[model samples]
Target: MPELIGIARLAAESPSLLGKKRVEYMSLTTRSYLTRCNNPRMPFRWMINPYRGCEFGCKYCYARYTHEFMELRDADAFEKKIFVKSFGPRRFLGELRKLPVGESIAIGTATDPYQPAEALYGVTRAMWEQFARTAGFRIGLVTKSNLVTRDAGVIASASRRHAVTIVVTITTLARDLAGALEPLAPRPELRLRAIRTLARAGIRVSVNLAPVLPLINDSEASLDAVAKAAAEAGAVSLGANVVYLKDCAKSIFFPFLEAQFPALAGRYQERFRNNAFLRGAYPEMIRERVGRIRRKYGLDSSREAAEPELWPRDPQLTLFS
Candidate 1:
C-alpha cells in the first residue's frame, strides 16, 4: 500500500508546489462502468455518464451517493478517485442503438462530462462523435467546464440532425465564492465565454443557475446579474433553482456554508432539516424571480416537456400500429 505524506513535505520537495500547502491527496484507477438513473422529473429517461466521480468538487454535489455504492468511505477521496470508462463510448453507442432511434438522451446527468480529467481521457468526445451520425433524437448536455468548446464543431453538426441544447451552469458571479463552492471546475467567465462560442456557432445555449443556495446565492441582485450575463452571452433560455441538500451532500455543503456564510447556516438547517427537496415556497419564489429576470432580459424559460413515456420503447414499431 502507498503511504500518505503531509502536504508540506510534498510541496517542499515536489516541483508541483503552488501557494500554501494543504489537504492530503491520493489516487486510484478503475475500468468501464455505467449508471442508469430512473429520472421521472428530468426531460430524459436515460443518462450517459462517461466518468464515475467528478473532479470539480462542488460542495453541493448530489452524486456523492454514488461513491457509497462503490464502497468508497471517504468523501474527499471520491473527488480524486475518478474512474474512466475506456470503452464507454462504444458500449453506450451500442446500448443507444438497441433502443428506439428517436429516444432522448441526456449526457452528464450524474457527473460533469467535461471535467478537467476529460482533457486526458477523451471519452466524451468519442460519445459525441457516435451521436453525430444519428438523427431525430434529442440530446442535452449540462456542464460547467469550458472544455466543451473543443467539441463545438461536432456539437454543431449533431444539432443539424437532432435537437441539441447545451446548458452552462453558473451559480455565483463572485470569483471567490465560485472558487470556494466549485474548486476544480472552470471559472465563471471561462464558462460564459464558452457559452458565447457555442451560441455564435448556432448551437442552442442556455444558462442553468441551479441549486441556488439560500444566503449564499439567493439574493435578487445576484440572480438578475446571472440572467443578464446569460442574455448577453446569447443564451436562448435561462433557468434557476434553489439548493436542496440530500444525504452525503449535507456533509460536504454545510461546512462550507458555516465557514463562508455563517449567518445563513442556521436558516438552512431549520428549513431543510427533514426534507431533502427544498420547501415548496422556496421553488415558488425562485420561479417567480427567475421568470421576472427572463422577461426582463427577453430570455426564454429553459423548461421542456416531460420525458416521453415510451422512452425505452421503439417509435417505429408504434408508427404503423
Candidate 2:
C-alpha cells in the first residue's frame, strides 16, 4: 500500500461521526481553514471547504479528485464518505490576517459548504458568523443546496461589510433529469427559491448552468428555460460552461452516462479521449448560446474595478464555482 501523509494521514486517524443510509460522515482536523490557491489561472487567492466530501452525489462532481489525497479510491466513497473539518474562531481570525488586503476568499471550493453536513456540524455557519464581524473583504460561496438560505440573516450580515457573491448552481430545470443527475441534491425549484431569498435580502446572487452536456440538456430551448427561471427568481447573472471531464471525474461520470444515456456514451468517449477540454466549435457554440440566453434575460454580472471578479469560477470552473 502507498504510504499516507498529511491530509491522508489525518483522514485515516479521524473518527467516524455518524452514518446515514449508505453514507458515513467523519471529522477531519486541519492546521488551518484557508487553503492558499496556487493555480495561477485561478482568480481567487484562497479557497475554503468546510467539508471534504459531499453527499449531494452529483455524478459529474469534479472535486472527487480531492479524496485521492486521503487514499480513498472507492467510486461511491466520494458521496458516501464525508469529512467535516474542525473549526476554531481564533484560528480563522488569524488566517484572515495572513491574507493580503483586497484579495478574494471563496467558500465551498471543493465541496458544498452548506451540504447536509453543515446543518449538523455547523462549520460553514461558524465561518460566516466570523465573517459577519469583519469588513472590506471579497468572499464568494457556491452551493447547490437550499440549506444556505437557513443562514440568510448571517450571510446578509456578512455581506453588509464585504463584497459577497453567492452562486447557486442549477444545471437544468427538468425536475426528473435533475433528479437523475444529482440524485441526492435539492430540487431545481428549491435552488431557484434560494436565489430569490438571497436577492430579496439584498445579497448579490447568480445562477450557474454548468456542465452543459452534449445532447442532453444543451438545446437552446433547454438553456432558455433555466435563464428565464433565473430572471424571474431575481438573479443578477446567469453563467454557464461546457463540462470538462478530468480522469478522476470521468471514472464516475462515464459509467453514469453509459447506464443512463447509453446512446451518447460512445460519442462522449471519443470527444474526451484526446483532451479533457473540448476547445473547438462545441465550446464556442455553448458560449454563444449561453451568451444569447443571458442577453435575453438581461443578465449581467456585477463587477467593480475596485474589486475582484467572484465566480461562476470554473475556467468555464470551482476551488470552485
Candidate 3:
C-alpha cells in the first residue's frame, strides 16, 4: 500500500494518474483514483469512481457492497479509511483513447466524487481536466456534495463542448432527516447552493430525489418542496425514485429507519416484504405527485420523462450465463 506521505507527494505532483498502468505500489495514501464499470443497467457504458468507500456513509448506500469486495469490514471505517486510486488521470485518458469514442461517461456511479475527501485529494478535479482535454464524449456527474461548486469553471467549460449534466442527489430538505439518513453528507441547503452556482455558470444542473424512503421522505409535500427548490435553483431537470435497499444496505438502513421513524418502521417492513424492488402503487403514486409538482413549477417534464435508465439490460445475457 502507498503510505500517506507518498500519496501526498503524488497528489501534489500529479493527481490525475489513477488507471492501472500508472500504479506501481499500492499505498494507503490519500490519493485520487478511478474505476471502469460495464453494468448493463447503467446508462453509461463506462464509469469512473474517484474513490473507494464513501465518507457520506448513507445507511442505504448500495456501494457498501463494494467495501466487502475490497476485503474491508467494519462499517464505521467506511468514512475514515478511503483508498485513492493512483495514476488515475493517465489511465483514464489512455483508456479513453482506446475505447470507442462518443460514449456517455458517468462519474460518481459507485461513490460520490465530491465527497469531503475531495477537498484534500483533488482527484475529481484532475479527472475533469483529463476529460476536458479529450473530446467526443458525454459526461455526467452525480453527487450529494456542494463541493462541486469549487470546480464550476471546468464543469461549465465541459458543458459548452459536450453533453454534461450535473445531477445533485438530494433526498429531503429536512436537515434532521438528512443527518439521520446520510450522516456524513453535506446538508441539503449546501447542495442547493451548488445547484445555483452551477446553474448560474451555465452548466446544466438537475436534482435527483433518490432513495425516497417509504413513509419517510415519500410524502407528497416533501416531493413538491424538492421540485420547487430545484426549479427555483435553475435546474433544467428533476427526478424522484423510491429507495431500493439491497444487501448490507438493508442491515444498515432498516435499523436507522426503526430508530428515527419508529411509528412507520412496520409500515416499511410490510410494504417491502418479499419484494426486492419496491413495487405496487407506491412508485406510481410518487411519480404522479412529482409530475404534478413539476408542471406546477413550470419545469420541463421532458427532462423527467426522458431521463435515461441507469443501465440498459442485454436480453442475451442470462443470469446464469
Candidate 4:
C-alpha cells in the first residue's frame, strides 16, 4: 500500500475554513517547532515560523520555494495556500529546552507570524505566552505587520525571562512603492508607527531594509529616509541586504517586473540570469551606504546583545545549568 499520508495528502484532505481574500489556511501537524539553521552566515542557530506560506505575496519573496515541499507547484500557491502548523505547547517547550543555552531563535524567518490569519488562530500569541515562562534564550521576532504592536505586553513579559529583539522589516519609506511591492502587507507608515510603539514599550527594536531591489528602492535618498525615520522612532539599529533572486523568486518577481516596471525588467533579468547574488562592488556599495546611514542616525549596525543583567538568575532558567 502507498504511504498513508504526506504533507501534500494532508493539505488536500483538510483546508481550514478560516479564509482571507484570495488566501486559505491549511492546518498541518508538526513533530517539532524549532528548526536548526546550519547556514554559517545566519547569526541565528534556530528558527520558528508560526505559519508556512505568506499572504503578503511580495513579488521578490525568496521563501516561495517552500511550497514545493508540499507538492504545491503553482507559484501563487505559496501565498494563497497558507499552511498553519498545529501548535503543541508541551512539545514546543520541550524542544526549546533541548536547544543550547544562549543560541538565537528567530520567529517569522520564513513567514509572518502576524499575518491576517493570526487574528483568528492566535498561534503566534500562544507561542509568546509560552516564552513568557521560559528564560536564557535569545529570541528575535521579525514581521511587517502592525499587528505585532498588539502583543507588546506579552513581549515585555517574555523579556523578563529571555532576551527578545523585535525586527520590523520596512523595505521603503514610500507608501506607493511599498504598496506595489508588498501589496498585501501593512502600509509603511503603519509599520513605522508599530516600531515607535514597540520602542516606547522598552522592547529592543530594529528595522530591516532587506532585499534592496536595485533600480526600485535602492537610492541613497530612499535608504536615508528609512534610516532617518527608524532613528526618530527610537530604533536601536538598521540592517539591510541587497536583493538576491533564486529561481523560485524569479518566476514570480520577473513577471511582476514586466507588468509594473517594464523599463527595468530587462536589466533585472540580465543581472540575475547568471547568478542568484550580485557580486563585486554592488554589495560592498550597499554596505558602505548602509554604514553611512547608520552613522548619520547614530544607529548600530548589528542587533543589540542581551545585557548581562537581563539574564535570569534562576538555575532552572538555563537549558544546561
User: Which candidate comes out best when scored by TM-score?
Assistant: 4
**Off by more than 4 A, model 4:** 1-6, 308-321
Instruction: Please give the RMSD to the true structure for each candidate, in Å.
Output: 7.2, 5.5, 8.8, 2.2
lDDT of 4: 0.86
What is candidate 1's local distance difference test score? 0.74
The stretch of ten residues in a row with the least summed lDDT in candidate 3 is: 303-312
lDDT of 4 at 79: 93
Better of 1 and 2 by TM-score: 2
What TM-score, to 2 decimals, does candidate 2 have? 0.93
Which digits, one per residue and each the tens of the lDDT, describe model 3 over residues 10-82?
A: 3334333233331221234333233456667667766778776677889878787765655445554455456
Off by over 4 Å in 2: 302-321
The lowest-lDDT stretch of 10 consecutive residues in candidate 1 is: 11-20
Q: lDDT-based ranking, best first? A: 4, 2, 1, 3
lDDT of 1 at 142: 91
lDDT: which is higher, 2 or 3? 2
Among these predicted structures, which one has the highest lDDT?
4
Residue 163, candidate 1: alpha-carbon lDDT: 73
- Alpha carbon lDDT of each predicted model: 0.74, 0.85, 0.71, 0.86
* Cα lDDT of model 2 by residue, 132-209, tens digit: 765556888989999999999999887766788888999999999999999989999999999999999988888889
